[model samples]
Target chain A: MTMPDSSASLPAAASASAPSTKLHAVAPTALPPGVRDLRLDFFRGLALLCIFIDHIPGNRIADYTIRVVGLSDASELFIFISGYAAGLVYMSAVAREGFLFSSLRVWRRVWQLYVAHLFLFVIFTAEVAWTSMKFDNPMYVEEMNIASFLSEPHIAILEALLLKFKPVYMDILPLYIVLLVFFPFALWLIRQSRLLALGLSIALYATARIYHLNLPAYPEDAEWYFNPLAWQLLFVIGAILGASTRTFANSGMDFPVPRNRWLLGAAIAYALFGFGMQFLWEHDLISRVFPHGSEAFIFPTDKTNLSGWRLSNLLALAYITAYFLRADSPMLRWRVFHPLIMCGQHSLNIFCLGVFLSFAGLIVLVEFSDSLAYQLLVNGTGIAIMIGAAALLAWYRAKERMPRKPAEGPAGGANVKSTALGGGSAE
Target chain B: MTIFHFSRRGSLGWRTAVMTVLLMAAFSPGADAAEATPPQDLAQFCAVPETVLPNGFLKHARDAYRAGKPLRIVAFGTSSSAGTGAASRADAYPARLQADLQERFTLPAEVINKSVGGQSARQMTSRLEDDVVSLEPSLVIWQTGTVDSVGNLQLEDFGRALSQGIEMLEKEGIDVILMNMQYSRRVELLVNYSPYVDMMNAVATQSGAALFDRIEMMRHWASSGRLDFDNMPRAERASRAAKLHECIALQLADMIEKAVRR
Candidate 1:
C-alpha cells in the first residue's frame, strides 16, 4: 500500500512518527496496506485548482500559484503525480496479476485518458464556436484562438484526432495522453533495472532537447506545448518513486524522508536561489545584473522542453516537500483541505470541468464587466462548483460501490489487483 | 511656437503639459484646451535609457553603417508596423525611421515594412523567407506578441516560434531586434499580456536579439499622462497615433545609432 494502515482514526493512524522526529531508524521493515494516502490526493487537487485559476487569464489569484515562486508550475506537479499514482496502482497489479494482465490495465487507463481528451477537445471547440458566432465583437472569433478551427472544422477534427490541433489550454491532456502511452513500458523497464531506466530517461531527455525531437502542432510550424519526449523524464522519475517501497509517507518523490540535515540544507538553499531569481525578472535592475535581462544569468527556462533549471528547481522543491510533509498531519483533516482532497480524488473530472469553466469565466469577464467584483465572483463560484461537483461524484461513487461485493473492503485500501476498472485508480 | 506636428509626447515635461491641458479640457465648458496648451520641451518619455546597451552586438550592421553603405532594414510585424491605427503608411514607424536615420547620419537607409495585419509569430515565421530573408537586409526588427496574446495562443508555442524564427534569421547573418506588443491598458487588463511580454524578453535574451520594449514605453507614456489610449478624443486619434509612431521611430533610430556607432 502507498500508505500505512489508517482504518482506525483514519487521519491520525496513517503514521506514528512526528514530522519533526529526527534520528529515526530506517522506515519500519514491515510495510502494511489498508491505507489510502491522501497526500497524493492533496497535492494533485491543489495543482488542479492552480491550473484552473491559471487557465482563466487575468485571474488575480493566479499570482500566488507556484509560477511566481519556482520555475516549474502546475504542469510539472500534475505529470509527476500522475506518474507517482500510476506506479502505486499499476506496480501492485504487475506483481499480482502478471505482466500481460497489468499491461491491459495500463492500456485501459490510456484509453480512458484518450477518450477524456477527445471529449474535452470537442466540448471546448463547441464552447468557443458558439461564443464566436454569438458574440457581438467581430474580434471575438479571432481572440477565441479557434479562428482557423472554425474555418476548416473538417481538417481541425482530423488534426485533433492526430493530437495536433491543440489551441492554448487544451495542450495539457494531449501531453498526458501521450505520457500514459509510455507508462507501461516504463513500468516494465523499471522492473528490470531502476538505475538503467533512470539513465535512459535522462538520456532521452538530453537527446530530445539537443535534437529538437518533438511532435509538431497543426496550423503552425511550432511544436507541441508540452513536448512528451522531454516531459517523460519527469513522469518516469515520479513513477519510479511511486513503485518503490522504500519511499516515505507524504513524499511523492522517490527519496527517503528524514533525510540528512546537510542534504536538506542544500535543497533549501537551491529553492531560495530559485525564489531569488524571480525578483530579477521585469525589474529595471535586471539589465544591470544580467546585462541582457535574466536569461543570461538563468537561461530561457520556458516550459517547452523542461529546461534543466526548471527540473532542478522542481527537484529541490520536492526534496523540501519530502522533508516537511507527513501522511496524516492534523492539518490534512482541517475542513479547509477537505475540498482539495475530494477534488484530488476525482481529478480527471474536476480538471476537465475546470477547463470548461475557465472558458466560461473568460467570456464573462470579456463580454461583461471585468470589474473586481466579477473577478471575485468568477473565482469563488468556479471553485465552489468544482468542489461541489467533486463531492457529488464522491457520493455517487460510494453509492455505486455499496452494491459491489466488498471482498477486500476498506482493508484493501491500495489493492490494485481489482483490474483496470478498479485499481488504485487515483487518476 | 513650433508644434513640430510630430510625436512629441516622450518627455516628462511634455506629459505634465499634456496632463494640465487634459485637466483644463475636462474642466472648461466647451473649451478646446489642447489647442490652448503651450509648446513643451520633452525629456525621456519613450526614451530608451542611454545606459541600456544593446545586448546583441550589431557587428555587421555597425560595419555597414561606418562604411557609408546603403543600409537595408526590414520592418517585419503586424498591424502597428502596417500603420493600422496611424494616419497613413508614411507616418508608420518604419517610414518615419527611414527619415529619422537619414537625417541623423545622412546615410541612405531603406526600412521596408513587411507587416500584414493580424498576423502572429507563427504566421510571421511562415513568411520569413518570402517577405524578410529574400530582402537580404542587414537587420530585421520583428514586432510580435500582441496578436498572440490577444488570440490566447499557447505561450510555449509562441516561445518556440519566436526562438526558431530568430535562430533562422541569425543563421542568415542578420541582426534581429524583437519588438514586443504595443500597450493599451484595456487590452493589458483584459488579456494576460505579461506572460507574452515576459516570453518575448526571455526569447530575446536567449537568442541575443535586442528587445525594443514598446509595451513598457507606451505604458510609461500612459502613466505619465502623455498619450491616453483609453481617453484620447476621436478628433486627435489620428494625430496621436502618428505622434506615437514617430516617437517610436525616433527611439529606434537612437537605439540603432548607439548600437551600431558605439
Candidate 2:
C-alpha cells in the first residue's frame, strides 16, 4: 500500500458535545464530540441503509425495496453530501486556524482516508478472491486477482500513496480523499471571500469541462463508473454550503417559505421528474444520446457531472428533507433513529463496516442464490450480520468512552480549542 | 466617300458576327434546356462487345470450353453476400463459383465481388449507379433481400428499389441476374418480406433479367439431406448452408455463359 508519510498538527474546532454515557447510551448525545448537524446524520444513516439494500446481491426483496424507495443509487447523493460535508468541516478549519494549519489538517484526513482505503481494498479483494476460487468462475478469478490486484504496480502504488484514483460512485473514498486535498485551498479562497472561492470553483469547473479531464482507469480492464473532475463541482458546492452555515441557519437552509405548500410542491415536482426521467431511460431516449449512461449527457444517472435534471431533483429532495427535519415526525424521535444516528455520527467507521459486510454478503449470496430456500436464508443471515456488526461497534465505542481529540498543535493544544470556539462564534 | 467606306466595313463586321452567333445557337444547347440529365443508364454508354455463340448448345458449349478470354462477372449484396461467415474469403461461395465457372467453361474468368456488409436492398439500390451500373458488367449477380426482410423496410419500398435497380441495369444493357436470399426460419414468418422476395423475382421476369431461386435451391438441398445440419459445428451451420447457395450461384454462372455466348 502506498501511504503518504506526513504528520502534522491540526487545531480542534467546535467544543466537544456532552459525552455522558451513564445509561445504555441510547441517546444521540452520547456520541463523541466535534460532530454536529443532526440533519447530516439522518442522511448519512439513510445513505448507508440504502447501500445495504443495493449490495444485498440478487435478493428480490432488496432490489424491489431499493428501486421503490429510489435508493438504488444513494451513492450519488452521499458523494454530493461528502463534498458538502468536507466544505463544512474544512472551511471552518481555514476560517479559525489559518491556511497552513488547515492545509495540514486536510492532509492528515487524507492520510487517515488512505489508511481506511487499504483496509477496504483488502476486505473487498479477499471477499472477491475467496468467492471466485470457491465458485470456479474464470471471469471472477481473473478480475479479483490478475486484473484488479496486479494490473498496474506503479499506478496502484501511486494511488496507495497519494490516495488517487478515478472518482466514481463505487470508488468514492479515493474521490473524497482527493477532494479533501483541495478543501483547504477551497476554504482559503472562501475566507479571502465567497466571491473569490465561487469564482475559482466555477473557473476550475469550466476548465475541467473544456479540457475533459478525468481520472485514469485500471490499465488492464478500464472500468470507470465515475469521473472526478466532473463530480468536483458537486463537492465544491457542498463545501460552499458547509462553510457558511450562517446562511443556512438564518434562512433555515432556504426554507423560510410557507412549509407545507413548498413541501407538497417539491414532493410532487420531484416525483414527476423522477418518474419522467425513468420512463425516458426505460424507453431508450437518453441511451440514444450517449448509448451507455455516459456522464456527459444531461440525463438520469449522470452522477459525475450532476446533470441539471438530477441536480434539480436532488434540490427538491433536499427541500422535502429539510421540511421533515424541521417538522415533527416519528422518524426524528424514534429509538431506532438513535442507532441510525450513532451509525451516522461515526460515518467513517460505519462506511468501512458497510463496505466490508456488503462485499462479503454479495459474494456469499450470489453463490447461494441458486438454491431458492438457501437464497432467502443467506439474505436473512446477511442482514443479521450487518446489524450485529453495527451493534459491536456501538458497544466498543461506548466501552472506550472515546472523545474526538484535537490534533497537537505546533504552538500547543490551547490553540486548538480557541480555533474551535472562534469558529463556533462566527456561526 | 470615307463615311460610306467605314459604314460598309462596320456592316460587314456586324453581319459576320451575326452569322457566327446564329451558327453557335443552332449547335449549342439552349439556356432552358437542362444540362444535368440525371444519370441515364451509363452501362449502355460503355457499349462493350458480346461474344456471339453459334446456333446450337453443342456448338456454343464447345466454344465456351475453348474460349481463351476471361469471363467478367459481378456479385452484389449484404453481409452474407460479403461472405462474413465464410472460414476465409477464399471459401466464400462467390470465389468458389468463379473457380467452378472457370474450370467448367475452360475460361479465365475474373469475378468482381461487390458485396458490402450490413447493406439493405434500399442502400444497394441507392448506390446502384456507383456499384453495378458503372461496371457495365457482363453478368450482374444480385444477392439481396436478407436485410430487406430483417430490417423491416416496407415491402413497397423494397419493390420500388428492386424495380428501379432492375430497370436501371436493363437500360444499361447489362445482363442482370438476381439471386434471391437464402432461407432462414426467422424470415418465413414475416409475410411482408417473404413476398417481397417474390416481387423481386417478378421484377426480374418483367425486366428480362435471369432470376436465380437460391431460396428454393437451398430448400431442395435441405430436403435432399445434402445440407449437413446435424454434423456441422453450431457456428458453421450457416456457412455450410452456403453449399446450396454456391450451387445456385454456379447455376446462374452457367446461364450467364449461355447469354454471353449468344
DockQ values for all predictions?
0.08, 0.01
The clash count for each model shown is: 3, 8
Q: Write down the lDDT that model 1 would get.
A: 0.70
Error of 2 at B125 (Å): 25
Off-target runs (Cα >4 Å) in candidate 1 are A1-32, A127-146, A246-258, A282-285, A291-294, A402-424, B1-74, B84-112, B116-141, B145-177, B182-196, B203-210, B213-262
lDDT at residue B164 of model 2 (Cα atoms)? 82
TM-score of chain B of 1: 0.82
Task: Give model 2's DockQ, 2 decimals.
Answer: 0.01
lDDT per residue (tens digit) for residues A1-427 in model 2: 0000000000111111011122214444332324356666567666776666555433355544323433124666676567656666665566557779868867877777778887776444333333333333211121123224334445655654544432111366777776777777777776666556665666676676576555655432232234566666656665665665433233222222234464457566775667555555434354344434252233324444444455555545655665556422336567767766555655676677676655544433332221334445544554455556667866785455324343354554445544443332111
- Residues A74-134, model 1: lDDT tens digits: 8898888888788777777787789898888778877887788898887666554444433
As a TM-score, model 2 comes out at 0.49
